[model samples]
Structures are given as C-alpha cells and as structure tokens.
Target chain A: MKKFIEKIIQGLFTVSGFVTSIAILLIVLFLFTEGMGLFKNKLVEDGYQLVVNKQNDVSSLSAEQIKDIFDGEITNWNEIGGRNQEIILFRLNDISNYFTDEELGSELEFVPEKISELIAQHPEMIGFIPQQYIDNAFKGKVLEAGKIGFSDIFLGKEWIPTATPVSFYGILPLVTGTLWVSLVAILLALPFGLAAAIYLAEMANHKMRNILKPLIELLSGIPSVVYGFFGLIVIVPLVQKLFHLPVGETGLTGSIVLAIMALPTIITVSEDAMRNCPRSMREASLALGGSKWQTIYKIVIPYSISGITSAVVLGIGRAVGETMAVLMVTGNSAVIATSILQPLRTIPATIAAELGEAPDGGVHYQALFLLGIILFVITQIINSSVEYVSAKNKI
Target chain B: MNITLKKRRSQHLAFGIVSLLTYSIVAILIIILAFIIIRGIGVINWEFLSTAPTDGMTGGGIFPAIVGTCYLILGSAAFAFPVGIMSGIYMNEYAPKGKLVRFIRMMTNNLSGIPSIVFGLFGMALFVNKLSFGDSILAGSLTLALLSLPLVIRTTEEALKAIPYSFREGSYALGATKLQTIRRVTLPMALPNITTGLILAVGRVSGETAPILFTCAAYFLPQLPSGVLDQCMALPYHLYVLATSGTNMELQRPIAYGTALVLIMIVLLVNITATVVRRYFANKVKMN
Candidate 1:
C-alpha cells in the first residue's frame, strides 16, 4: 500500500513538471494561431470596397500602394502601374465635400446615386465606398483590395493600425522605437551598473555590501507602475523644463526609467560573477606588484566576461519586455522616431494600450497578437543566448 | 618609481568613480522613496484606507483595489505553491540527471523570461477566451501563477538543495521510504527558504499590472469582488488608469501618488519580511 501511494505521488510530481513544459508550448501555440489570423483579412476595411470609373485602367491595388496613395505619398496613378494621370482620392465623407446637404436629399437618400455619378464623372477618381453602395446599376468598377501580406507587416513603414479605408499594420516604427529605447537604456545602465557591481563585489566592506545589496534588491521589488508614476510626476517635468520641449514624454524619459529598472539585475548578476573569481588569482596579481584596479581589469573581469555578458543580456531583456512603465511615460505615438527626444511607441506598450479595445478575432486584435509573437521571439532568442552563455560558463 | 606612481593614481581614480556611481544609485533610490512618502502621506488617513472610492475616483479611498490585489496574491499563491514545490522536489530528488531534465529547465527559464505582457495575452487567449472564464479573478490568478511558477520552482529547488544529504540518508537507513525521508527530513529543513520564495512571489503578483489588465482588472468597480468570476480593481492597474487615463488627471494625481506609495510599501514590506525570515532561519540553522 505504501509503495502504491509512493507511485501515485511520483506520478503527480512528474505530471506537475510536464505542466510547465506544456505551458510554454501553449503560449507559443495560442500566440501564433491568433496572430496568423491577420493574413486572412483583407487590406481594405471590412464591408468596404474601392471603386473607380470604368474608363480608368487601374484594376487593383496592393495593400502598400493603397496605403501610400491614401497617405498622399503617391499622388500620381502612374507610380503604381496605372494610367499616367493624377489620382483623385474619394471616401464616403468626401461626398459631402462635393455635394450640398440639400442635393443629397433628406437622410442622405441620394448618397448612393450621387456617389456613383461622381465616380463616373471623373476617370482619375478612386472611391472607397461601402459595398452596399456599389449595386448592379453602379457606373464604376470595383477594385480588389488584396489580402494583407507578410511584407505589409514586417517590412512596412507605417504603423497606423486603425486608419480609415485601410489600417496600416506596418511594424517598422514600433520595432525601431522598441530598439531605440532599449539601446539607450542599456547605454545608460551599463556604465553605472558595471561600476556598482565592481564596487560591491571587490571594494565594499561586508556591512556596506549587506545594506546596499538588499537596498538594490528592494529597488527591483518595487512595482514598475510605481516607477512610471515617479517618472510621470518627476522626470517628465524635469526633462521638459531642461530641454524646453513641448512635452516631456519622450524616448529619453522611458530610457531613463528603464535604466533605473535594469540596474538591480545587472548589478546583482555581475557582482555575483565578479565575486566568483578565485581569491588566489587576485592575490597573485597583487603579489606580482599589480595595482588593485589592474588586478580587477586584467584578471577578474576577463575571467568573468561571459557572466557579465549574460548579465547585460538579461538587462536588455528586462528593458525590452517592460510594459507598464514604458506605456505610462513614453508618449504613445506610432511614428518612426528619428531622435530620442521624439515620442514613440513600443510593441509591448502598444499591445497593453490597444489590446483592451480591440475586438476579439478581429484584424486589429490579430495584429496585436502578431506583435506579441514578435516580442516572444525576440525575448526567446535573448533568453536562449543567456542560457547558452551561462551553460558555457559553467563548463 | 614613476610607473608605480601613475598606477597608484589611476587606481585611486577608478575606485573613486565606482564608489561614486554606486552611492548615486542608492541616493536615487532614497530620492524616489522620499518623494513618494512626502507627497503621499497626507492622503493616508483612515478614510483613505478604509472607504470605497467616491466622486469617480477623485475622492474617497482605494480599499477595493487593495482587497483585489490581496485576492489575486492569495489565489496565485494557492495555485503556484504546490505545483512549484512538487516540481522542485521532483527535479531535485526524483528525476535522474538527463537531457530531458536539461530541456525542462530550459523551458522553465524561457517561460520566466517571456514578457509579462505576453503572459497577459496568453491569459486572455487561454483563460479568458478559450476557457470562457471571461475577465475574472480566477483567470488573472492562473495567469499570474504561470508567471511566478518559474521563480517558485527555482527557489524551492535551491532551498531543497541546501539541505545536507546526511539527513535523508539517515532517514533511509532507519527503514524509511523515499517519500517519508523527504517528507520528514528534507522538506522541514527547506521550509523557511520556501516560505521566503512564497513571500517574494506574493510581492511580484501584487505589483503586476499587464497580466491582469485584460484578464481581470476593472477600471473602477464600485464593489469588491464576491466571487472568483467577478472583476475587481487592482492597485497597480488602478494607479496606471488613474495616472494615464483617468477622468480627471489633476484630481487624480495626488491619489495616484498615494496609490504608488501603498504599492511600494506593500512590496517593500513583503521583501523585508522575506529577508528577515531567511536571516533568522539561517542564524538558527547555524546555531544548531
């Protein structure tokens, strides 16, 4: 009976271990399955179609070209393999711009007729109208808006995910914004973190180390939302005042906050690495007439280089994955940031801010999931590399 | 002599720089703590701590959010501790050292490193939508349980590993079963460290906002959650909403500070308790 009970307990333990492995699999499965639903969606808004005069030669437009045309970047039809004429943009709202309220009749009863008539009158015009408006008597040809392609997301430039006629799911701005903030954060954190690690590991007395180490751990334990609140109340105003900027919620503020957050991880990890250096090596350096700094810079640091590298990598991981603080401080703008002073949006921040409002199983919702996949992939690579480096260090 | 003098000067400079940088970090921490305490103390009266929020969260207290965070912490701990402790025991005591073990360890590490927001998305997908729990405390707790599971397992394994092998061997020599040996000897010795890990997990679960933002967190629920299926406000999420997307930013600013202070205090309190428990236990073990 005891043996049987032991077997049962062992089975429970084995099953529990498998639970973690299965969880990782499930996260990947759900993220990809939901995210890949984006491709099945059309580039044009649902329930809407692009219509042009039958005389026009332009038959269809790729998602990119349509976005470019609507954004006013591509004004000539010739640019997109169409007839050599200026492209005229039209939307449902543009009907009111061309016609008076009286002309459209009460309750806009003549909107469909007037829209078809307007499209027929101008060969260069492309109208984005409701599918219901394009009936059998419509004088224009319907243009097929192709489904969203992979390049429209990975390599595309714009990230306006809720634009009318078509929402841009281009990830360039978000990717670059995330990279910029993380890069600056690492740049700011590395010197300070390394210095602190060196001091605590080699220089500080036991008492000082005890107090300071726990203090730093306490720093890490503080919730990120608190850091964000601190940033919003204090750093934002300070940055604005110093730079004379219109708003303080720039990439720099986010970098500063992330740097602060990353400090404890970097310091703790690197300090442990440095402390692991053999005492005999330091003694030999000092016995050979080497200075304290020389012994550290030459022997201890080189010996623990892999550990320090893994520490920095972990710091980078933290900075990249942080959501709440970045969302709170970084002025959530979905533009490709050219400078640190400019406001930009990060992938995690964008997800956190937008996922609440995105309808379930919709294209916008799928796009956010795709962003999650990108983040998951990036962090997985970082984590696996950290694992590899530390594994190598152990060997 | 000249080279030696130059080396000494450079060493002094390097030491000065590192010491300055280290203290500056501590100083910054102090400034942050001080700033919050100074600004938030006025709003920390009995009314603020005990009453429900009023006037669209501009007046009254943050009692509901505090209670919600407490529920989440308890729920996550309940789900995570048994699985985590058992997994740690399995790895340390039962599982043979092999490639499979290495693979499981890698997966655990990767899971922990996955962004909290990704966990939020996963929680929304699995617990909220797929499982049809719909935004509720149960879903949020399960999500947080996943997030903290890796930490708990890692710490528990370390705690178990710290116990000397002789105790287990002695139990076995006395004709005890493997489970009995572990239950009576190793687990009791490891309990204090495991408790520390549990406290730290509570600290983490309390402060998490992204994972609960969609799974369970309500912008402002007038009443406390009476069931696991109900939505509730959490301190971190409440602070985020008030700071970023509140009805009145000006009125909510002070309250946001108060909320932040409360959050920091709870996390710090939990951390201090963990540290004290570990220290006291370490000394006790040494004395024995």
Candidate 2:
C-alpha cells in the first residue's frame, strides 16, 4: 500500500510541470487568435502606394511628388511630382465632402496650408488622403480600400487609431511615441540601475545591503497609478514651466517617470545575479594584484554578462510595457518625433487610452490588439534573446 | 603598487556614498508610510470600519471593501496555493534536469515578467467573455491566482530545496516507503516555509489592481461579497478609482489614501510575523 501511494505521488509530480507549461502556450495562442483577423483582407501588407503617375509612367515619385500627392489644390503645370507638366493629383477631399467633428483636428487644417504650398510651387501636384476620406463619391475612380487595406494606418503620417470602421487606425504616431519614451527611459535607467546593482552585489557590507534590498523590492509594490499621479502633479508642470513649452507632457518627462518606476526591478534582479557570482573567482582576481574595481570589471562582470544584459533587457521591457504613466504624461499625442522633448504616443499607451471606449472587434479594437501583438512580439524577442545569450554563456 | 593617503580617503568616500543610498531608501519608505498613516488613520474611526459606504463618499466606511478584500484574498489563495505548491514539488523531486524540466524552469521565469495589464486583458478575454464569469469575485480571484502562481512556485521551490536529504533517507531506512517518508518527515519540515510563501502570496494578491480591474471591480458598491460568484468592491480598485479619479474626486482622495495605508500595514504585518517565525526556527537550529 505504501509503495503504491509512493508511485501515485510521483506520477502527480511528473504531470504538474507539464500542466504549467501548457498554460503559457494557451496565452500565446489566444493572443494570436484575437489578432489574426487584421491580416486576412491582404490588400496591402505594410506599404504605401506611389499613386501611379499616369503621364510620365514614373515607377516611383520623388519626395515632392509624395508631398504634392497630399495637398488638395495642386493641379497645374510644373507642380511637383518630378518636374512633370500639368499634373492633376487626386485627393480624398476632391472625391467627397465628408468632413465632420472639428474636435478631431479635421483634414481642413492640413489641407489649406498644403494646398497653398502646392499651388505656389507646382500647380499640377495632388495630395492623397485616407481611403475613408475618399468615401462613396470617390469610389470606383482611383482610390479605395481596394488600393489600401486596413494596415495603411501604420504607413501614413496621421495618428488616429480610434476612428474605427470608418477611418484608418494609424498606429505610426503611437508606436513611434511609445518607442521614443521607452528608448529614452532605457537610456536613463540602464546605467544607474547597473551601477546600483554593482555596488550592492560587489561592494556593499551586509547590513547596508539588507536594508537597501528590501526597500528596492518594496518600490515595485507601490502602485503604478501613484506613479502616474506623481508624474501629473510634480513632473508634468515642473518640466512644462521650466522649459516654457506648450505643455510639460512630453516623452522626456514620461521617460523619467517610468525610469524611476523601473529602477527597483533592474536593481533587485541584477544585484541578486551579481551577488551569487562565486567569491573564489573574485579572490583569485585580487590575489593577482587587481584592484576592487578591476576585479569587478574583469572577473565578476565577465562571469555575469548574461545577468547584466538580462537586467537591462528587463528594464527595457518594463519601459515598453508600462501604460498608465505613459498615457498620463506623454500628452497622448499620436505623432512621430525626432526630439526627446516632443509629445509622443506608445503602442501600450495608445491601447490604454482608447481601449475602454473602443467598440469591441471594430477596426479600432482590432488595431489596438494588433498593437498589443507588436508589443508582445518585441518583448518576446528581448526575452528569448536574453535566455539564448544566458544559455550560450553557460555552455 | 604603493598605498597612498589619497587612495584610502577616496575609498572611505566611496563607502560613505554607496551606503548613503540606504539612507535615501529608508527615508522614502518613512515618508510614504507617514503620509499614508496620517491620512488613513484620521478618517479610520470605528464607525468607518463598522459602516458601509453611501452616496458620494460622504457617509461610507470601507466595510465592504475590507471584507471584499479578505474574501478576494481567500479566494485567490484557494485558487493558487494548491496548484503552485504541487508544481514546485514536481519540479524539485520528480523532474530531474531533463529538457522538459529545463523548459518548465524558463517558462516560470518568463511568466513573472508579463505585464499586469496584459494579464488583465487575458483575464477579460478568457473569464469575462469565454467562460461567462462576468465581473465576478471568482473571476477576479482566479486572475489574481494566475498572477500569484509564479511567485508561489519560486518561493516553494526554494523552501523545498532547503530541506536536508538526511531526513528523507532516515525515514526510508525504517522500511518506510517514499510516500510515507515525504508525508511524515519532509512535509512537516517544509510546512513553515509553505506558510511563509502563502503569506507572501496573500500580500501580492491583496495589492494587485490591473488584473482585478478587468475581471471584477465595480465603480460603486453599497453591499458586501455574499458568495463566490458575486460581484464585489475591492480595495485596490476603490483606491484606483479614488486616486486616478471618477466623478467624486474631492470625497474619494482621503478614503483612497486610507485604503492604501491599510494595505501597506497588512502586508508589513504578515512579512514581520513570517520573519519572526523564521528567526525563531533559525535560533532553535543553532541551539541544537
């Protein structure tokens, strides 16, 4: 009877790990199932069209042509599009007059300035609006969903993804915005977090390490919304007034907020890995007359490459995945930017900002899920790469 | 190389500076704790504990939120502890350094890194939509359970690994079978650690918001959680509402701070008790 019970216990244990692995697989599968619908229509995968210049048969239009192709009244001689004569560029506005919701920053704002610029320089240039703006009046002519499928939102300059079934779910602004914030966050966090970790693991005395350790761990337990609150009250206005910018809610401020939040995790994990590094190795390095810093850099760090990198990568992951803080501080502007100070959107922030009111399984919903998938993939790449490098170093 | 007075002074400076970081951490903790206690304590009269919340946070105590907090934690413990502990047992004892075991190890680590909101999304999709467990405490607890499991597994695995092998061999030497030895000897030895892990797990689920936001959290609640399937008001969600804001910004902020204070206290108490028990046993071990 005892032997039988022993066998039963062993059997149960064998199966438990298998069950846990299956749970993770199910999560990945569910994400893909929810998001695979966006790729089905297949009109365009992820590219912009050249608008097929009829006169010159130019396969690709110049940058000016791309610009003129967006302005409404660029319709005359030498009007951009690579020195072409007498061009008639078609815009969605020329096709239909469906302009509403002035609060949404209507196409009219960009249309006027661009139209004058096109008219002044080259009369024959035309601009391209979204296929949604192209509507029924413009259908069966030159532009439609037939020419550009749903994914063109990522391809274009516009930032709107919440327009749903009617408008393009342009993720370009939000994606770039998120990338910019997280990128800056990683830059700020990586060095400080690493140095702190190094100090705790290789240098600090036991009592000091104990006190610092739990405090850092406790920081993660602090709710992220509080961090959001802090950013709004403190960081946002301070930066705003300090720089005298239009608003303090820019990507740089968001990065700082997130960096503070991420410091705990990066410090804790990296310190643990470094602390676990063999004492013998360090002693040997010192026996060879190496200084403390030299021992740490040459001996300890060399043995712990994977841990430090994993620490940095995980910090980057936190920056990428963080939502509420990013949403509250990044001004929610869905625009691509070159400067760290500019307001921007991130994929996670875009999804969080709009997911609550987003109509379920609508174009906006699908688009948000698509962004989630992108975020998921980027983290997976980071996670798997860390695991791979760690394993490689071990062998 | 010759030792210089400057080198010694600089080394002293480095030690002073590095250790100074500990002061800042402790200071931050004290400031945050004091802010919570002051705000949370003033309004936390006996009536506040006994009464229920009413319209616009004017005359509401956090009775339901506290009870709901308790019920939610109990449910999450129920949901997570059995499976997580079992998985740990399997990893430590049965699966021994094979490819499958290695894969399981990696998955456990990866599981912890997943963002809480993504877990919220998964719960929203799976529980609210697929299982039809819409906005219920059971739904919330199960999601919290999933979130807590990785920690439980890691903690329990370490706990189990700490047991010396001599106890196992002695039981087996008495002609006791493997199952008998583990149950009679190994399990009793690991019980304290198991409780330690459970305490930590409880602390984790109590404070979590994102997953519960998607699965359960109602904006306003005047009642208590009556059953497993019932919708409930949770402390974290209430705090989330109060802090980030809703219609009642002025009324809710103090209550939110009070709730946060209550949360931090509960977690601190649990951790301290566990540490004391651990120290007691360690002392006993040393005396022997």
Candidate 3:
C-alpha cells in the first residue's frame, strides 16, 4: 500500500514538472495559431469592398497603397498606377454628402443605387462600401484586394488596425516605439544601476546595505500598475512642463518610468554579482597597494563581468517586456516616434489598449495576437540569451 | 607622486558619483511613495473601502474591485500552490540531474520572461476562447496562475534544496518512503520559505492587469461576483480604466488615487510579511 501510494505521488510530481514546459509550448502554440491566422484574412475589413468608377483604370490596390490613399498621403491616382487624376476618398457615409436624405430614402433603401451612381460619376473616386451595397447591377467596378501578406505587416508603415476600408497591421511603428523606449530606458538606467550596485557592493556598510537592499526589493515588489499611476500623476506632467510639450505623455516619460522600474532589477542582480567576487582577489589587490576603487574597477568588475553582462541582459528583458507602466505613460499613440519627446505606443501597450474591443476571431483580433507573437519572440530571445549568459557564468 | 595624486583625485570623484547615483535612486523611491501617500490619503475613508463605485466610477468607492482581486488571488493560489510545490519537489528531490532537468529549468526561465501581455493573449486564446469559459473569475485565476507558476516553482525548489540531505537520509533510515520523508521532514523545515514565496506570488498575482483585462475584468459592475463564472472588477484594471479611459477623468482621479493607494499598501504589506517570515525563519534556523 505504501509503495503504491508513493508511486502515485511520484507520478503526480512528474506530471507537474512538465506543466511549465508545456505551458511555454502552449503559449507559443496558441499565439502562433491565432496570430498566423491573420495572414489568411483579407486585407480589407470583412463584409466591406472597395468600389471605383468603371471608367477608372485602377483594377487593384495593394494594402499599402489603399492605406496611403485613404490617409491622403497618395492624393494622386497616378501614384498607385491609376490615371493622372486626383484620388478622391469616399466612405459609405460619404454617399450622404453626394445626395440628399430624401433621394436616398428614410430607411436608406436607395442608398446602394446612390452609392453606385456616385462612384460611377466620379472617375477619380475610390469608394469603400459594404458588400451588400455592391451587386452585379452596380454601375462601379469592385477592386480585388489580395490577402494580407507578410510584407504588409512586417514592412508596412501605418498601424491603423481598425480603419474601415483597410486595417493596416504594419508593425514598424510599434516595433520602433518599443525599441526606442527600451533603448532609452537602458541608456538611462545602466549608469545609475551600475553605480548603485557598485556603491552597495563596495562602499556601503552592513547596516546601510541591509536597509537599502530591502528598500530596492520593496520597490520591485510594488505592482506595475501602481507605477503606472504614479507615472500618470507625477512624471507625465513634469516631463511636459520641463520640455514645453503639448502633451505630458511622451516616449521620454515612458523611458524615464521604465528606467526607474528597471533600476531595481539591474541594481539587485548586478550587486549580487559584484558581491559574489571572491574576497581573496580584493585582498590581494589591496596588498599590492591598490586603492579600494582600483580593486573594484580592476579585480571585482573583471571577475564578475559575465554576471554583470547577464544582469544587463536581464534588465533589458524587463524593460522590453514591461507593459502597464509604459502603456500608461507613453501616450499610447501608434505613431512612428521621431524623438523621445513624441508620444508613441509599444507592442504591449497596443495589445492592451486594443484587445478589448477587437471582435473574437476577427482580423483585428488576429492582428493583435500577431503583435503578441512578435513581443513574445523578442522577449524570448532576450531571456534565452540571459539564461545562456548566466549558465556560462556558473560554469 | 603626480600620477598617484591624480589617481586619488579620480577615485574620489568616482566614489562621489557612485554614492550620488545610489542615493538618488533611494530619493526617487521616497518621492514616489510620498507623493502617492499625500495625494491619495484623503480618499481612503471607511466608505471608500466598503462601498461599490457609483456614477461611472466618479464617486463612491472600490469595494467590488477589492473583492474581485481577493477572489483572483485565492483562486490562483488554490491552483498554483499544489502544482508549483509538486513541480519543485520533482525538480529538487526526484528528477535526476540531466539535460531534461536543464531543459525544464530553461523553459521556466523563458516562461517567466515572456511579456505579461503575451500571457494575456494566450490566456484569452486558451481559456477564454478555446475552453469557452467566457470572461469569468475562473479564467482570470487560471491565467494569473500560469503567470505566477514560475515564481512559485523557483521559490519552492530553493526552499526544498535548503533542507539538509541528512534529514532525508535519517527519515529513510527509519524505513520512511520518499514521499514520507519529504512530507514528514523536509516540507515542515522548508514551510516558512515556501510561505514567503506563496505570499510574494500573491503580491504578483493581485497586481497583474493585462492577464485579467481580457480574461475577466468587467468595465463597470457595481455588484460583486456571484460565481466563478461571473465577470468581475479587478483593482489594477480599475485603476487603468479610471486613469486612462474613464468618462470624467477629473472626477475619477481621486478614486483612481485611492485605488492605487490600496494596491500599494497591499504590496507593501505582502513584502513586509515575507521579510518578517524570512527573518523569523532565519533566526530559528540559527538557533537550531
């Protein structure tokens, strides 16, 4: 009986041991399965079609050109291989502008005919209308938009995932924004974190070290949303006032907040690494008449370089993975940020802000999942490198 | 002599810079804590803690969010603790030292490092959509459980590893089975550290927003959750909504501050408790 129970218990533990590995696999699997489904989706919004005048030369528009035309960046039809006429943007609602409500009827029964007429009348007009509004009898021709391809997402410029005619899923702005904020954060954090780590490792007395170490841990223990709150109330306004910007929420504010958040991880990890340096080395350096700082810079640092490198890698991972605090402070604008002073959005922030309203199993939802996959891959790379570095240090 | 003098001057400068940087970090912490306390203290009345939010979260209090967070904490703990402890036991006491163990360890590290938002997405896919749980406390708890699983496993493994081998050997000499040895000797010895880990996991789970945002968080449900399947308000998501997406930011700012204070206090309390538990256990171990 005892042996049987032990067998069951061992079996249970073995199963539990696989849980985390399985979870990691599942996360990747689910994200990819959901995210990769985006490629199978059409470039245009579901149930919507692009209609143009039959006389127009434009038969097709790539997702990029459609977004550009809609955004008014490509005002001339010739820019997209059409005739040398000005591109006129039209939405389903734009039909009202072309005709009176009485002519369209109260229930909008005649709206489709009116829409067909409007598109047919203006050769330069590109109309985005519902599929219900377009039939074989419609006067205009429908443009065939291809499935959303890899380049449309990876190389596209705009990130308007909810735009009516075409939802752009170009990750460039989010990718750039995420990298820019994380880079700035690392640049700001490394000096302070390294200095603080050095002070604690080399200079602080035992009592001071005890107090400061837990205090830093306490800082880490503070929930990130709380940090977001603090950032919104304090750093956002301060950044705006100092820079004379129109808005308080900017990439700089995010970087500053992330730097502060990353500081605890960097300080704790590097300080432990520095402290792990053998006392014998420091004593030998001192015996050679080297100063305390000299012993630190020459012996301790060199001895723990691998550990410190891992610490820095881990810090970068934290900054890149950080979501709530950056989301709250970074203004959540999906623009290609030109400077730290501009408001921008990161991958995590975009997912957090937009995932709620995205209809389940829709193109927008899958696009957000794709963003999640991108974020997951990036952080996994950073983390696996940290793991490798730390493992090497142990050896 | 000139070279030595210059080295000394440079050393002093570097020391000054390092100390300044160190103290400035502490100062920043102090400023954040002080600013939150000063601004948020006024809003934390008895009514604020006891009442449900009213009028689009502009007035009243954050009672439901607190309850929801508590439920999430409880539910996640219920799910994570047993599995985590078991996994830790397998790693430390049973699993042979090999590449499989190393791979498991690597996966744990990677899982812990994956962005929380990605976990949110995964949870949405697996629990909310695949499992058809809908937006519910159960789904949220499971999602948060996965997020904290790594922390729990690592801490449990560390705690179990700290137990001296001789204790297990002694139990085995008395004809105790492997499970018996662990249950009767090692687990008791490592209980305090395990408790500390569990408390820290609670702190982490309670504060998480992204995982719960899609999995369970309700925008405005003044009433408390009636079942595991019911969607509920969570404090972190509440603060996020009020701070960013609320209808009247000016009116809701105070409540947002109050909710933030409540969150900070919970985290602080958890940290202090874990520290005290660790210190008490350390002293006890020293006495032994």
Candidate 4:
C-alpha cells in the first residue's frame, strides 16, 4: 500500500510537469489559427467600397496603389493601368465643394443623388462613399479589392487598420517603429549598464555593493505601468521642452523609458557573469603590473563576453516586448516614422490600443493577432539564441 | 615615459567614470521613487482607500481596483503555486537526467521570454472565446498564472537544488523510501526559498496590465467582483486607462499618480519581504 501511494504521488508530479509544456503549445497554436484567418478571402471594408464610373478602364487596384492615389501621389489614371487622363479624387466630404447647399438641398437629404450624378458625369473620378448611398439605380462600377497577400502584410509600409474600401494590415510601420525604439533604447542602455556592471563587480566595496544591489532589484520590481506614468509626466515634457516639438510624446520618449526599464536586467546579468570570472585570472593580471581598469577591460570583460552578449540580448527582448509604457508615451500614431522625434506606434502598442475595439474574428481582429504572432516569433528567436549561447558558454 | 603616464591617467579616469555610472543608478531610483511619493501621498486617504471611484474615475478612491487586484493575485497563486512547485520537485528529485529534462528546462526558459502581451492575446483566444469564459476574473487569473509559472518553476528548482544532499540520504538510511525522504526532509528545508518564489510571483501578477487587459479588465466597473466569472477593474489597467485614454486626461492625472504610487509600494513591499526572508534563510543555513 505504501509503494502504491508513492507511485501515485510520483505520477501526479509527472502530470503536472507536462501541464505547463502543454499550455505553451496551446498558446502558440491559437495565435497562428486566428491570425491566419485574415488571408482566407478577399479583403473588404464593412460598409464602404471604392467605386469608379464604368467608362474608366481601371476597375481594380491593390490596396497600396489605392493609398497612393488617395494621398495624391498618383495623379494620373495611367499610373494605375487606366486611360491616360488626370485622376480626380472625390470623397464624401467633397460633395459640398462641388454643389451649393441649395443644390444639395436644404437638409442635404439628396446628397447621395447628387453624388451618384457627379460620379455618372466624370469618367476619371474615384469616390469612396458608403455602400448604402450606392442605390440600385446607380450606374457606377465597384472595384474588386483583392485578397490580402503575404507581401502586403509583411512588407507594405502603411499600418492603417481602419482604411476605407479595405483596411491595410501592412505592419511595416509598426515593425520598424518597434525596432527603431528598441534599437535606440539598447544603444542608450549598453554604455551605462556596462559601466555600472564593471564598477559593481570589480570596484565597489561590500557596503556599496549591498546598497546598490537592492536598489537595482527594487528598480526591476517596479511595475511597468509606473514607468509609463513616469515617462508621461517627466520624460515626455522634458523632451518636448528641449526639442521644442509640438508634442512631447515621441519615439524618443519611448526610447528613454525603455532604456530605464532595461537597465536593471543588463546590469544584474553582466555583473554576475563578470563576478564569475575566476579569481586567478585577476590576480595574474595584477601580478604582471596591470592596473585594475586594464585588467577589467582586457581580461575579465573578454572572459565574460558571452554572458555580456546574453545580457544585451535579454535587454533587447525586454524593450521589444514592453507594452504599457511604450503605448503610453509613443503617441500611438500609425505612421512610418522617419526620425526619432516623430511620433510612431509600436506593434505591441498597436495591439493594446486597438484590440479592445476590434470586433471578434473580424479583419482588424485577425490582423492584430498576426501582430502577436510576429512578436512571438521575434522574441522566441532572441530567447532561443540567448539560451543557446549561454548553454554553450556553460559547457 | 610619457606613454606610460598617459595610460595611468586614462585608467584613473575610467575608474572614476564607471563608479559615477554605478552610483547614478541609485540616484535614478531615488529620484523616481521620490517624485511619485511626493506627488501621490497627498491623494491617499481613508476615503480614497475605502470608496469606489466616481466622476469618470477622476475623483473618489481606488477601493474596487484594490479588491480586484487582490482577487487576481490570489486566484493566480492558487492556480500556479501547486503546479509550479510540483514540477520543480519532479525535475529536481524524481525525473531522470536525460533529454526530457533538458527539453522541459528549455520550454520553461522560452515561456519566460514570451512577451506579456502575447500572453494577453492567448488568454483572449483560449479563455474569453474558445472556452467561452468571457471577460472575467477567472480568465484573467488563468492568463496571469501562465505568465508567472515559468518564474515560479525556475525559483523552486533552484531552492530545491540548494538543499544539502545529506539530509535526503540520512532519511533514506533510516529505511525511508524516496517519497517519504523527500516529503519528510527535503521539502521542509526548501520551504523558505519556495515562499520567496511565491512572493516574487505575487509581485509580478499584481503589477501586470497587458495580460489582464483583454481577458478580464473592465473599463469603468467600480464594484467588487462577486464571483470569479465577474468583470473587475484592476489597478494597473485602471491607471493605464486614466493616464492615457481617460475622458478628462488633465483631471485624471492626479489619480494616475496615486495609482502608480500604490502599485510601486505593493511591489516594493513584496520585494523587500522576499529579500529579508532570503537573508534570514541564508544566515540560518550558515549557523547550522
């Protein structure tokens, strides 16, 4: 009976171990399932479609070309495989420009009628009006928006998830924005973090080490939302005042916040690795008439290079995955940022900001899930590489 | 002679610069903490701690948020601690050292590195939709449990590994079985360290905002959760909402600061307790 009871307890422990493994698997599976749903069919906006007068030869355009046309970058119809004529941009708001209040009626109730008439008269015009406004008697042609392809999702530059006619799920802006912020953050953190690690590992006395160690741990333990708040209140305004920007919350603010957050990880890991360098090496350097700084820079640091690399990688992982702070300070603009001073939105910030309002299983919803898949992939690569390098160093 | 003198000067400069950088970390921590505490202490009062929020979350107190965060921490602990501890024990004491053990360790490390937001997305997919739990406390707790599980497992494993092997061997020498020796000897010795792990997990679960945002966080719910299936307002999520997307951003700024202060205090308290417990245990081991 005692043996049987022991066996039962052992079995329970085994089962518990597998439970965690299964949970990780399920998370990866669910992300792909929902995210891949967006590519199954042609992308269409819920209540609006791009329409052109039938006399125009252009009947279809990719989401990218449509965006370019709307931005007035494509001014000629020939640019989008149509007849050589000047492309006319017509929108719902443009109705008032073309007709008077009396022509559109006192209440503008006949606005759709006038819109249909305007579309019927112009062959070079493309209008983005509501589907409800396109009555049965309307004579214009609706453009066939193609299915969202992998290139558009992976390589396209725009990140407008609420675009008319078709929501652009291109993640280039968000991906670059995330990378740009993380890059700047790591660059800012590395010098300070390495210097601090070197001091604490080799130079600090016992009292100094104890005081600094707990404070660094305390820094790491502070919740990320508090960091976000600090950035919003302190760093954001400081950047704005110094740079004289219209808004204080730019990618620079995000980089500063993330650098502060990533500091403790880099310092703690590198310090431990440096401390683990055998005492004999340090003594030998000093015996050979080497200064403490020279010994640290030339011997201890080179010996622990792999550990320091892992520390840097882990720091990058933290900056890349951070959500609340970046969301709070990066201004959440879904534009391709050209400078650190410009406002930009990150992928995690996009998911956090937009997922609450996106309807379940919709295009917007699936696209956000795809963003998660991308994030998971990036972090997994970084994490696995860290594990591999550290494991090799240990061996 | 000039080159040697220049090298000596450079080394001294490097030492000065590095020490200054190290000291600045402490200064930065103090500055951040002082800024929040000075701004936030005035907002904390009996009314603030005991009353639910009103006036679009710009007034009143954070009573409901406190309750909700407590519920989340308790719920996640209840789900995570037993499984994580058992897994650690199996890895340290029972499981054969082989490829399987290595695989489990790799998985745990990978899970730890996954972003918290990914966990949020997974929770929404599995708990809120697939299982039809909807947005509720249960969904949020399970999500947080997954997030903290890797930390708990690693800490427990380290604690178990630190226990002296002679204790287990002595119990076996007295005609005890493997199970009895581990249960009667090994676990007790590692209990304090395990408790430290639990404290760290609590610190993590209470402060996380992203994982709960989709699974359970309610925008304006100001009442105590009646059941695990009910929606609740968490402090981190509430602070995020007030600071970033509030109806009146300027008016809500004070409440945001107050919430941040409360969050920092809670996390720091847990961290300090963990450190003290760890020090006490280390000293006890040395004395023995």
**TM-score of each model, paired residue for residue:** 0.95, 0.79, 0.94, 0.92
Superposition error at A301 for model 2 (Å)? 4.1
Q: Write the per-residue lDDT of candidate 3 for residues B185-219, one digit (tens) a residue.
A: 99999999999999999999999998998999998
> True contacts preserved, each candidate?
0.79, 0.21, 0.85, 0.73
Model 4, position A73: C-alpha lDDT score:
89
lDDT of 2: 0.69
Which is superior by TM-score, 1 or 3?
1
RMSD of 1: 2.4
> Which residue pairs clash within candidate 3?
none
What DockQ values do the models have?
A: 0.85, 0.36, 0.84, 0.76
Task: Kindly report the docking quality category of candidate 3.
Answer: high
**Model 4 interface RMSD over true interface Cα atoms:** 1.0
lDDT of 1 by residue, A328-380 (tens): 89898999999999889899999999998899988999999999999999999
lDDT: worst 10-residue window of model 3 chain B? B30-39
Model with the higher lDDT, candidate 1 or 2: 1
TM-score of chain A of each: 0.90, 0.71, 0.90, 0.85
The list of candidate 4 runs beyond 4 A from truth reads: A46-56, A68-79, A84-143, B1-8
* lDDT for position A128 in model 2: 49
lDDT of each: 0.92, 0.69, 0.91, 0.90
Q: What interface RMSD do all candidates show, one decimal each?
A: 0.7, 2.7, 0.9, 1.0
lDDT per residue for candidate 4 within A261-281, as digits (tens), equals 999999999998999999999
Task: Point out where model 2 deviates above 4 Å.
Answer: A1-12, A41-144, A147-159, A245-248, A284-294, A297-303, B1-6, B9-13, B20-26, B49-52, B57-59
